[model samples]
Target: MWESKVNIYNVFELRSRTLCYFGVGAINKIKDIASALKKEGRKKIIVVTDEVVYKVTGAWDVIEPALKENGIEWVMYTGVQPNPTVEQIDEATKMGKEIGAEAVIGIGGGSPIDTAKGVAILLEYTDKNATELYEQTFIPERAKPVIAINTTHGTGTEVDRFAVASILTKEYKPALAYDCIYPVYAIDDPALMVSLPHNQTKFTSIDAVNHVTEAATTLAASPYSILLARETIRLISRYLPEALAHPDNLVARYYLLYASTIAGISFDNGLLHYTHALEHPLSAVKPELPHGLGLAMLLPAVVKHIYPAVPEVLADIYEPIVPGLKGIPGEAEKIASGIEKWLFNLGITEKLSDFGFTKNDIPKLVELATTTPSLDLLLSLAPVKATKEVIREIYEDSLNPMS
Candidate 1:
């Protein structure tokens, strides 16, 4: 008999304490989390989201009636921003309290859901000063259980228990806080995604691709995470284009929705490195770039430069995912080339200038990106120690999309 000795290291860890309730096409499935909350006999429910998703995705309409049908009275907070700030969290938290809401349901993409997490965290953990919850060292005792309804598939915020909320640094530098991983329920629905515009569909799928790639390649990947990440990358590659080409393809949407969730779990365990660590600072500097598009623009360059750092691991991880390149010695580069080609075919271009980044801006961008506190977190696990200069190279490549 063969004996297996498995080793796990500094890969991302999801706390065993995080609770998750998952359902597909759960637009109507709000009843499950609602019932759970009601069983706890909660008084009121607060549905947090941004205004655009509220009007465009029809999530608000579907969710409102579903809650009413379940006899769960609720209030809606639709002011969550694209990148939510501390003030939005406070306002939402105040509304949750004013309505005597006993539970919170995040009902949109990452922005609303992330905002909901921040608000819910403070409601339970803070005594008088809710903002203090951002600084809490330990995971805050999860406040009211949060049920997330994902209308657009990106960020995997609904499935993952983590949240990203912005704060101001002492120098007034833009900073972010990672609160407790507290998503109690995730409702993923493909029907919710069918109406997404072409550009958003492109950017979000790229985001999912980034999740799978970053997670699968990161150090300390476990057997479970490896399986999940590989499958996610394969599925996203197959289905994302189909979804973009035929926006109404429920089958494509269904596959990508499932892919997003799987990728979410993969990264929630592997933790993001590389592109994401650097992307946050870019987002702070260029608010309109959209984090997903920024990642799409920078990913190919980052992968190309980082390949020499972890050639063996990248080769192993990509060989199975790229059938045509099987048995090739340089499978990592081949798979990455395949990814860049696939991205190009999908209408995604790599020029940062197209997205408002400039050649002259490279040095300042590198300085800012390297300064992210999370940079060390990612660098510690990076196959090659990413340096300030290497980061500038990635930026240079990204500045010229035509390259």
Candidate 2:
């Protein structure tokens, strides 16, 4: 899809350390990861998860058996919820410390995995807690090794070095990205993903799409990022609909899983900008809001704002979804409105107001976007810098129907 790219001289730096396995039967490899840990005399582990996904995905069927056979005793911490909070991370960290679990396994989507990342830090820095980890001043350089068993098709926290947790009292959702959080092992089994609910299939897949979009256009954009982003967009555009129609179709689930994985890798190297920087605030203010929905709400407006600065990159990556308009000039609003409609067609019919936000909330969203810990750093990566006024415009433009 990035046929127009011709920059051969821009320097690139790609980074990832996780040993990841992908396929229908890859979950069994957890046996290998666990057995190696057992050899190291590490017998205790904390399984961080939201209660439902672990069992519903049948991941527990594989993980429990593997851990038991490897003589690894586990403590279960199931308090994680969507847009995981500091309180939840601290609760799990306390349980993990009580058991002296030396390593952590995260099972489920981003929330559980992100909580596990937070727990991994608090476990090593025993005196500190999740509150300190999210304070934005402490950049953790060392953490207990994490093993990620992914159950959903989006938020490749399994494969990426990013985690997020909220400080509810401060209405802050701060994301932490560090080399230390990269999982020691990552398992992405498409078989575990076929059972995903229809809404989750849509929401999670859209999150991956947003990831690729931002990766292709962020100021950190590289040929490596663009290459992965193109293939990710192609696969998701072809497969997300089929997965939604036939939730049990393994082939569709397989490609979507790969799509999400590559999308994760794309961002790991390319970084992110407006969509994520802005969406975190929406969920922080309403902690129950689905993260993908928040991204979907802001994505079109964010794209509109940055399109002029990186038109070629935006056009290249969006070709699969919006055809015949790639190289055209003066089509920012068209692409923006088209994506907004596409999201609505995928069943996310609710607007920002539908989620109880209004013009009154614009100032608050702006405040959070510009002031949230590392989010300002992300704003710096925008091709078009996100000032307070620009942040407000994106939030306001997202408040209602643009079509």
- The lowest-lDDT stretch of 10 consecutive residues in candidate 2 is 1-10
lDDT of 1 by residue, 1-403 (tens): 0002224444446533334444445576666666777778885878898877766876777777667766888888889876566678888888888888878888777888888887777677555433454434445645777787787766787767666655544111132334354577777888888888888888887788787667766664556666676677777778887888899898888888787878777777776677876676677676566768888877877777766645544555555444544333354456556656767877886568787777787777767666644456665666557788777877787676433
What are the lDDT scores of the predictions, listed in order? 0.69, 0.89
**Candidate 2 residue pairs in backbone clash:** none
TM-score of each: 0.86, 0.97
The residue ranges of model 2 lying beyond 4 angstroms of the native Cα positions read: 1-10
**What value of lDDT does candidate 1 attain over all alpha carbons?**
0.69
Clashes of each: 1, 0
Candidate whose TM-score is highest: 2
| Candidate 1 local lDDT, residue 394 | 77
State model 2's lDDT. 0.89
Off by over 4 Å in 1: 1-24, 127-139, 168-180, 316-323, 326-336
